[model samples]
Target chain A: MMAVVTVAIAVQGNLFAVVVLGSIYSFLMATALVALDAVDVAMTEASVGAGISTVLLLGALHLVRGEEQKPRGRPWLPLAASVVMAGVLVYGTFGLPGFSDAGAPIHQHVVPRYLNDAVRETGVPNVVTAVLASYRGYDTLGETTVVFTAGAGVIALLRRRRRDRRDGDVR
Target chain B: MRNYLVLRVVAKIMIPFMLLYALYVQFHGDYGPGGGFQAGVIIAAAIIFYAIVFGLATARRVVPDWLVETCLAAGVLIYAGVGLVGILLGGNFLDYFVLDRDPVAGQHRGIFWVEAGVCVTVAGVMLKIFYMFAGRRREDDDA
Candidate 1:
């Protein structure tokens, strides 16, 4: 299902349809995350990908043409590069441990400590919350700063465009 | 959209519920599969839905630009302020263990405020981006 949606989005000519298909793809990805038992990731994917991005893309679409233009030429070089990268990624994954392997390196390290002691240490029932907000506070803070920076960049660009329009130099 | 009474009415009814759910997700994150990021986006989505149904001007009137900007900064301040407090109490930065007399309670206190800060900032950022895009379109229409 997700593969079909991805193909549809890739091939779609209408910008609006692409956006809609992208949203659907995000939804499918979120569902896949849920099936993988990564509820936190699923939630983030559903909200950020399917919800907020769809709206943002639609808003952006309003400022641009509604249809995608045909490619000026066949891009064989980029296609070959993409295929090579995909092959490398697939080759890289071969070294990974089996899915849900109990003795995997990751499970052997901090997983036990977090599962056994996170509640007692952080006083939060949800280990994910404890890990995100307390154990790894610095990382979350950095993530927040990234979001802040992106917001500032968008505001600056939009404000500059408005100013340009006011000065009769509209693009 | 303005002429679509059904859309307006449904949005009116749904926005409050959406907001309430966002709050629930925000505060109940410690026990569930949600937290500040999801809650913040949900809150922003509610407001965006209202804007889509009732028009951006009306939505902006309800949630003024100044307020959104304030939220963007204030949330970061709150998070950093808590960390500063930890340092003042002779602990390392963002040390939740020193937030209260009891270490466990301190952890709870720190996590709650940090999550609150995250919620505020995330909601603010989402709304700010939405405003920038929507407002530009409005200005183009005006000119």
Candidate 2:
């Protein structure tokens, strides 16, 4: 299902179709993440990747031409580069510990504390929340800063109207 | 789209529910498979749906640009301020243990505020990006 959407998005000539297909692919990916038991990650993917991004893309489409232009040249070099990178990644993953392996390096480390003692220590029944907002909170703080930065960047770039565009020009 | 009766009606009906669900997700994140990031995007999605059905002007009126700008910075302030409180309480930065006399309760307090900050910022950014793109199209139309 996802592969079909991926190919359609790549081959579709109409920009709108591509955007819709991309959204479908994101939904499929979110479903797969749920199956993998990463429900939090899945929700993020479905909402951010599928829901909000589709709207953003549509807004973008309204600003640009509706049709995707044909490629001017073959993409052999990039294709080979991507294929090689994919193969390397796959080969690297083969050496990883088996799924749910207890003796895995990660499980042997702070995972134990987060799993066993997090609830008791944090008084939060949800270990994910305990870890994200309490134990490893600094990381989330940094991520929040990054999200704000993105908003700031967009506002700076787009706040000027046509008349103000001339006035705001530094050059 | 403006003249499509069914589309407008459905969007109007769904927008409120979407906002409600966003709040549910934001508040219930502590116990479930959700958090600020997911809930924030959901809130932005609700407003974007409204803008599509009604108009950008209406949506902007509902969520003014100044409000978006404030949210964009306020979330970080909240998260950082919470950390500052930890320092003021004589613990290291982001030290939840020092937040309250009871360390466990302090952890809960710290996490709640931190998550709230995340939700606010995430929603703010998502809306800001969407408004920037969509508002540009509106300006082009006006010109």
- Tens-place lDDT per residue, model 1, B26-76, is 999998889888898899999989888888999999999999989888888
TM-score of model 1's chain A: 0.94
Across all models, the iRMS values in order are: 0.8, 0.9
The TM-score of chain B in candidate 2 is 0.94
Candidate 2's C-alpha runs over 4 A off are A160-171
Candidate 2: tens digits of C-alpha lDDT, residues B1-143? 66889999999889889989988888888788898888889998898888888888889999998898899899999999999999999999999889889999998889889988998899899988988898788778875
TM-score of each: 0.97, 0.94
Cα error, candidate 1, residue A158 (Å): 1.4
Cα lDDT computed for each candidate against the true fold: 0.90, 0.88
Candidate with the greatest lDDT versus the true structure: 1
- What is candidate 1's CA lDDT for residue B29? 93
B134 Cα displacement, candidate 2 (Å): 0.6
Report RMSD (Å) for each prediction in the order shown.
Answer: 1.6, 2.1
